[model samples]
Target: MSKTVTFVILLLLVIKTSVVCRAQCSQGAIICETFGSGPRGLLPQGITNFTYRARACPDDGEYTLLDTVSGDCHGQAWHPILEDHTPNDVRGNMFVVNASYQPSEFYSQKVAGLCPGVIYEFSLWALNLNRILTAGACDEYILRNPIIAMRIEQPDGTLIKEIIQPAITRTATPIWVSLSMQFSIPTSSNDIVVKLVNKGLGGCGNDLVIDDIGFRPVHPGLSIQFSNSPDAETTVCADTRLSLTVGTATGYISPAYLWQQSQDNVTWTAIPNATLSTYAINPVRPGRTYYRLRNTQSINASAVGRAQCSAESNVLVVNGLPDSPFSLGPDQVLCEGTTQAIPAPTSLPAGTTFVWSDQSKSQNLTVSLAGTYWLETNFNGCTYRDSVIVESQNCRLDDIYVPDAFTPNNDTHNDQLVVFHAGAFLTYSFRVFDRWGNLIFVSRQIDVSWDGTFLNRPCSDGIYAWTADYSVLNPLNQTHHFVRSGRVMLVR
Candidate 1:
């Protein structure tokens, strides 16, 4: 053969081999069937075989091939039996299996041309047709109870897995239920059989309709990790910025991101316009909020298949300074010569530091003098302050005087003798004695006076010795006692 012809032929052979290998190594195929074909087309292509029994007449023996619509067997009009239908099957023709014909009936199909060792998911929609038949009537003859089972079998008919659905009692209104299962293809087996079986007795109400069966390969290892964010339970000041980044992703060709937030850590809502791997939050609110990133990975390079995963970042707590700490109670009045302690709020946030106006680190302040007092608190880089005025009143006995002369004759001019201006005294006493040093008058009241008489009788006019004693409160809240004595001339 010529050299050019030989080269061209070898290139063509290599190209063909490459194309075949690519097709073989590709993802598993998606097998989906809506089963909308009419009665004649019940055994559709790709399905291996099916077995069913139906009564020729209402009372006749069970035969193969029941009717398509569920309403046909019940002799009553019913809405379309299928829950959802494909665009091609808008009329929603479905496969109806009646337990009156056979106790157990099924449709089986062989899933061929699947990539070995790959994971695949299968799902189908099933409706209990018996509910519609028993609607608006109490028909005891109808047995509408049935259980659906999806079985995965080996080529030799050995059971690999059987997913038996929960028993469904017939209700007045029937609804479709979707069931799904995920399985991994065995490395040694490239093809398997899937069977949909109705496991119920041969009775009236055990009728079922099924549609929209699907099997597709899925990427099993889509995951994400969080990074470049604060640790969990971190406290930051309000209005601070928190930055987070997505670490890594697996089993995805093109991954997209969405940031979500939650207040109570339960109900989460997505943050709009946050679709990048890296996200930033500035001016966070005062309360605690939770954040997480949702990662969506496209299984194929063309973005045909998609898988989703999420990673929650550490929870960042935003804190602010507590309410002003200076509260001295309702009666802020401080008595003179007494020590008072100003109180502060005790519900401050953790890691908070307090400083008094006088630079004292204690939360409360004690003072004997009066002035304007204030406090400042710091928490999570935020500062709070409050102030109050401390008022003090002085009622001290600083001066006292006694008149040197008095007349008790009732002329209304200097008619009695008394001490003048006795200020805020805790105790006081006054006494008047005759010139012979004999006591004639005494009083404990500071304002009381002697009328120059003894026992309500006029005393002989003469010089009398008088003495006064008193005590007053000092600035230190202590009593200071004093005594003064003098001679007073009594004229009548």
Candidate 2:
């Protein structure tokens, strides 16, 4: 083929394969599509001194668009019902869950300027509600965000709380309510969790749109610091050493490090040579507690530390659950072809991950096959664990059996034999033969007893040979195999 022709043919072949592979993919999975930016969907960007017609304080705006199937879609407002609506009026995005806050996008495109102490102001047209049906549909969502969590926050002055945004109802003409909030952190938070939120509904994962998010400034020393981190307050196995980080300022470099922690954040105790980037949170106590970094220099422009450092990383919380205490839940046998969900509790402070002894992460599982299962959850800190077991549906075998040897001599008792499964379908075959590999009587699913009949009536008993065949699984991948051969005796 010519170069041009070859390239065209190859390109066509590649495109054809790509399309077929995605045939069962999401693009093909969508059953329906609709478009309506809700009362929250109204954009205020174009009109300065925007004009609108609202008859009441909590008025549903006029000249707005919304969906009949989905409720008021908007951003900026506190949705009372926590539905996943795009409040930003952006056409393409959906809502998703994080533990604390219900955010706007699953793939929230980078907001370019997200950093420490920066205050981001949220702005969007919120939907005025209660005009629409506040009552939930029969198909309200069932949440499903199951995660192994580790959250780091300087919860000191920063009001760091997980948020679940409500889904709002739709009204006539869909009125818009504008809502706004701000968040700022002075320092970095370790163990910051990036996770998903389950809406608990039938999977209504909604994400909204966000615009005009910016950083606002706060004062100095307003930042509180934590020293002995990740294990802010954790149960450590005997003699397990703890480590916490000491931070320098956002802009400047500190000459040295000083670590001070308290049995409480109050009454102070100092570690003699704890001058380093990370300190050993020692003289470890029992039960719950807190710790903070001691700055050698005062945290002010005129003083050394504020010019040098301010906030410690977000506080780390470690819980020391009892040693090797195993846990498991969803204690039920799952049905075939359906998934059963099992939840891991947050009670175990040390355990960080889960493993099925059989290597399955099936917190929720479809018991398609029968197997013995166990769950092993681990502690990321010191190697500790908790584990449990699960059982699956049983499989059955087909019965097919017949007598190897039989004497049809008008004998009454102990004359014949057969095999069968207690409750199931059956298939069978039986045969009798002489030593020369000649078949005497052979039949499949033979219901009548063999009477040692070569043709009919009784026959003589000798070392006559025979063959029997039946079906059963080999316990492997459940394949079918046949067994053949044997010898039998007939008596007169």
Candidate 3:
């Protein structure tokens, strides 16, 4: 094997040895042998060579299952353990054994249904039951500690992993210590046989209790430390770009690397082309973002295959920024007779402030007169600014139409003398005069027309003079006056 492979094995063993009860396999166990709740009994005949005892206390070369071990048993050679190590249980049985006078293989089980090339953790909880003193309270003698060899092997007797557990010596207070080992199944093997061989000689104090044996897949122990900060979480200004450097990565060997990011922490997406150990982002969009490094040890470059056997580093959080950057759009024109409304964004984070050029505090800015307009958005103590130009367009400078003659004989067609203007006028007046200069018809509104009537009586059909005066806005939005006169012939 290569040196990198050797280092990986040694590092895995060293890291797993220090973990306590809390560090069970996070991925669920495939082989959970709790010796679960049942009537006090022994394992099946073919499973182990140890004889079965029906009582609470088992003698030498014997094993039994019970929920609790009484203090009166075996002349109080073992601790009175109340319950098994199974979590969240009212009554659970623990396998209690007394080593024989000679060394022997005491426990064996065939584990199957495992995926090849995947790493697995084999672990169990053990408590040394030997009392501090011998049978007599006044007599002090050396007690025999229970030492066992944990082994994993192929069904054909090929050894895969074997380690001698340190002797479980008598402590002042009996507590369960977790013993765990990590190994990967080779492609040639799909099933394994696990064995426990007692190394301690049967004696006055070689009894122990076992519970919660587990076998589950585990990810490699991949980790990283930040270069600039010691914490996993930090803050960045909204206006500045974010740059992160991984100071130290555990065993930067031949493993393939891929970086991932998450917005909600539940769903993660792989960063594109981010295969290096360092990352830099400019104009970092706001919000809380999480990043992590994933390491895969594989010869194949397939993404799905790599993800199956990948290890992820601890998540690094960058938090407390504003919303993403926004644009105010291109410059626009506002007609003289119309109003335009520009609204500030309301979905920004709390305490966000918006300031317009005119010092208006409302969420919407309404304007008629045109000029340059700008806004400053402040969030998380950072400011973003954008400006836009608003120029004026005259609405009343378009063409107007007036007919020179009309037939006001009460028919729908050509019955009224109406003036039409395409553009809006600020002020208007129209009047019709008789040949003798008498005011026959008058109107101040643009749409109102003269229907050839005066004082509710029809006027005589004749030629008459008319005049119109109106004020309209010019290109500079200034009002300009115009007067026009025309002679219209009113026919019956």
Q: Rate the local accuracy (lDDT) of all candidates.
A: 0.56, 0.36, 0.69
Q: Considering TM-score, where higher is better, how would the candidates rank from best to worst?
A: 3, 1, 2
> TM-score of each candidate?
0.35, 0.20, 0.49
By the TM-score metric, which is better: model 1 or model 2? 1
Give per-residue CA lDDT, model 3, range 364-459, as digits (tens).
778787888887877767777778888887555645667978888877999999998757888888999999999989999987899988998888
Best by lDDT: 3
Using lDDT as the yardstick, the better of models 1 and 3 is: 3
- Per TM-score, the best of the predicted structures is 3
Model 3 stretches with alpha carbons more than 4 Å out: 1-55, 58-67, 74-79, 82-93, 98-125, 128-147, 154-157, 165-193, 198-206, 212-231, 237-241, 260-275, 279-289, 299-312, 324-376, 384-492
Q: Candidate 2: list runs displaced more than 4 Å.
A: 1-52, 55-243, 247-282, 288-315, 318-492
Flag the better candidate by lDDT, 1 or 2: 1
Task: Give the alpha carbon lDDT tens digit for every residue of 252-294 in model 1.
Answer: 4455566777888767687877877677776556767777665
What residue pairs are clashing in model 1?
54-63, 143-205, 144-205, 337-475
Taking the tens digit of each residue's C-alpha lDDT, what string does model 2 give over 320-379? 433344556544555445555555555655435666555676554334444544555555
